[model samples]
Target: MTLRLSSMRKGIRRLAAVDVGTNTVRMLVVSETEEGFRPVIRMRRITGMGKALRETGAIGAPEFAASLDALRDFRKELDRLGVVEYRACGTAALRESSNREEFLAEAARAGIPVGIITAREESRLTWEGISGGGGTGDGTLLMDIGGGSTELIAGPGKRDFVSLPIGVVLLSASFPLSEPPRSWELSNLGHFLAERIEAGTDLWKRRRFRRMVGTAGTFTTLAALERRMRIYRPERIDGVRMTLAKVRRWEKRLAGMTEAARLALPGMEKGRERYIVFGVCQAVAAMERFRIEDLTISDAGLLEGILRGLCGRKGRG
Candidate 1:
């Protein structure tokens, strides 16, 4: 039941959600009405919090500076648009950082409360956000791949979720692969990730979900490449099916390509080229271990989830 804009009444309240992720700072502003939530503004900037944390066990000065600048800009935008209520949440990077209090204080100065969300909260909120938007079945595996950690949720719907710490940025750094990684290297990485995923089999075996849905950059990029699209068309990629065999082939192709060659690939985002191989490898490993033959991609994730919840709350009020 997709709601249309015209159904919304006048004088609808506006809400904003800010996700300070390991690699990106994303903001979404939406209007709430009886019809549904309508997105007004959305933006993302790569801040690389995860990279700095891996090196120093803290959010480095450079990354902190970058995030502050981005947040300052986002503050101006939110004020300019007259957003009534807003919430900012930080994930793995901030949660694990040695100087999170300092960063939080900096964010407070900008009028944004940078709350460090626990892994449990991250999993629960993510499940709420995705499931609220619909399309989930009775038993489905929901996976969100971020820069610092990957979260896996399985249950009846959005109400039940479990999280994992395997993320693309962390995996890329931990598993260093030379351009065109050797077969042995690929095998080693795959085995290591598979073991981690296999640890979740107890829960997976209990529910026995038939479908897998993936959200975030990694799966979206793979969808674009698989379709050979020159531009990222969300309509085309979202809900697209990706098979384990196809992913394995793509991983091999990417693993064999030079950085220059990878940059030239269509639908490949410039900043993401370096880590795509690792992301693909992780996705493939999970799929193989879980016996998941195919996955569906979703552009909607935590941001959408937040918007939906905010709007629903306002509507009920």
Candidate 2:
């Protein structure tokens, strides 16, 4: 075998990963280094694909166009950056759509290949991503709270993971709330999620985790909003410990506010405000159901996992 100069200078290579999740589509580009992988470009947009799916069995006309357009733009940016390899996949929204083929066709038209991943795959990749943040063992579960679904995975090596239809969007759809949800409305939402969180409930009953590492939007936003950090600082939020008490605190505070007020609050994103109360509820439910004393938040998720896989493959070959 001939030795290549590029092999010794592999740290200069870059790769990309894209996650077409229910509520948001995100992409990340990173470069490999002796120190580890470092990020080059990151983009995320909430196109409300899942919200559209809930209202209709498919991505609505406008939603469809917007999502594909965003993707095409990302592809151009990735190309501009000279990313050597990229992987892209879609989760719950694409999985549940009755007209998923339409979305797939659009992606193909845009020259972007988007794979529809199963619930199990979503959980596993989420686990893979968070685990890369370190601390896999010693009774820690990786939890991903999405707009369309929630995943709970315990024991990374054993792969004890399940993706439930329980999500902020799902819960919001199931239990419509008034601005400042009526006590009864909140009760119904609690009861609705209580039944579906059985996977976590069962796990925590038998085993108590020392801590949990949470990924995806809900955890990240909650952590930032709690501290009133208008500017996102991934370094400060990542691996930071959040107590159950804080979860409940935010839950109660948000429940008392109207959608407009919630949106006006610091760290609250415009489109995400209304559904976030439910997100907080799910977080509280998870802490209680999983018997977790605290949570460590990780911003890395499906996109990061795919980037690692693609980058690692290139480095090896």
Candidate 3:
């Protein structure tokens, strides 16, 4: 049975989930009840895990160190919070890492066994995360713009899904544009992004999606920055609506600023400055390609999906 938004409150109690990605590691603790799952705690650390991924094809010392520290902290929290039900999953960065096993072993030592999810699994999780949240109405397309890859899943039924390798961190390394990225550079970047998305599926053209829901860091951060938030407030970002015009406006505005200027902007994270340009452009490209006029930004994603999975798959080794 599909877990509808209203039904998410049933089954299980306290659940914890961790999502390790190319640029960030995040943990969430929630309690499922009659109303819905209310967040007990949320923690995120920008580890820059994929900064050198494409160039090296392995986890480097700096990023790996960050991961170890983050995972260790996450484990401590799970213990302290008395979270018996939990799941930790890794995405694109770990999927591409030659030394991912080493990282996984280290994570296990911290009391959290990390599983690298397949792109298909990632897409399904993302879709579940969105659908379970209840904002999609009849049906909506969910897009998760990650550092190492972009996952798009069309839903209500999740009729189609695809995970593209063109992520913000990877694009940043591939296209080293000058500070205040030039028009030609942004154009080229947009084209490259659109080509991949276009080639990803014909579903967008054939099926009429009612709405678009964007998940992951890129979308949420953009929403935060638009509001000029000094600190990220998930409540303020969740279910917030953004139009394609706003996406383009931010794209142009950010492209005219230097790296330092981008960092100085409210809601901009220091480690992500290098990739935000391309990341924002990719979001813009997606909205245009899908012919979506507006989108709802979602702060919930893989971690939430993992938690829901744990609640559903109660008995497992």
Candidate 4:
């Protein structure tokens, strides 16, 4: 559905999109431009909303408080910027949590009413974000490695998507790895990731993508690390490509480092050191599973896709 706002008659419309995921809360504010949209501000916070879901079956106290605080800050930003239209979505952790309503209620009171989206809907929005409402005519395989789930989309239609239950946060939490992870632990993690991905994509076994494109935190963070950029520039990270060999290299190197050592790396995101190894393992498994040799990074994902939808430029997938 196309979203046309009468407010556009007055000229450029300011828009905002928030993604409340299992591990992080991110908000993007942009201004409509003749050339699509120009970012006004991008903010992210690692709230670890799914930190203890496996053991507790609910959002933990620390994560719940931090998430609400982040949303409150976003609310202030939106109000200050005079954002005309906005959409905030909650993903897998919220979808599966036993006490999601409590957290959702608190989030709304904090000024960000988040709608819990299904896995498939998350896949569609992710695809829309990567392609910018433009359909992928080349049969590109899109992967979004989120905190609680990983979405693999292969076609320009809604039916050809799979949201795998395994993600970095859940995977790491499910199997606690020793620092400088042991070989057996890495092996077990690899086998688990492979089996899960294979089972999830069995329905599309006959299909193949011309190329694989990875979005969300994992891929972009990997790109930033590869470049060793102390200050991340999205323009440089987006559209960058990496071969399977390079991916595997990082996987081995990172898996051998202690959390502190990893944190000391030039481009590692502060709170991501604990889980970055698992994230790379997931990427490597995906590459091997799909028989793809290289992966491309898309800095844009669900948030950007949400903005496009608000602009009335409906995405194709």
lDDT of each: 0.76, 0.76, 0.81, 0.86
lDDT of 2 by residue, 1-317 (tens): 01111322333777778888777888877777766577766777778777766667677777777789879988887667677777889888888888789889889788678998887877767777767745588888788888788888884444477778877766676678997799988888877677778644565567778787888888888877876877666676787678988778889998999999988888776678878888888878777777788888888878777765675564421
The candidate scoring highest on TM-score is: 4
**Error in Å for residue 112 of model 3:** 1.2
lDDT of 1 by residue, 119-203 (tens): 6677766666767755477657778888888888774344455556677777777788877688888888888878887785545
| Local accuracy of candidate 4 as per-residue lDDT tens digits, 1-317 | 01222232234568899999999999988888877887878888998999988889899999999999999999997887778888999999999899999998998899889999998888888888888777766758899998899999875576779898787889888989998899999999999999999999898888877678999888888998989988777888898999999999999999999999998998888889988888899999989988899799989889988887888753311
Q: Candidate 2 lDDT (Cα, whole model)?
A: 0.76
- Backbone atom clashes (below 3 Å) for every candidate: 1, 0, 0, 0
CA RMSD per model (angstroms): 4.0, 5.5, 4.8, 4.8
Give the poorly placed runs of model 4, Cα more than 4 Å off.
1-12, 313-317
- Of candidate 3, the 10-residue stretch with the lowest lDDT total is 1-10
Candidate 2 similarity to native, TM-score: 0.91
TM-score of each: 0.88, 0.91, 0.91, 0.94
Candidate 4, residue 44: the lDDT equals 88
Candidate 3, residue 4: lDDT:
15
Displacement of residue 106 (Cα, Å) in model 4 is: 1.0
Q: Which residue pairs of candidate 3 clash?
A: none
Which residue pairs come into collision in candidate 2? none
Alpha-carbon shift of residue 157 in model 2 (angstroms): 5.2
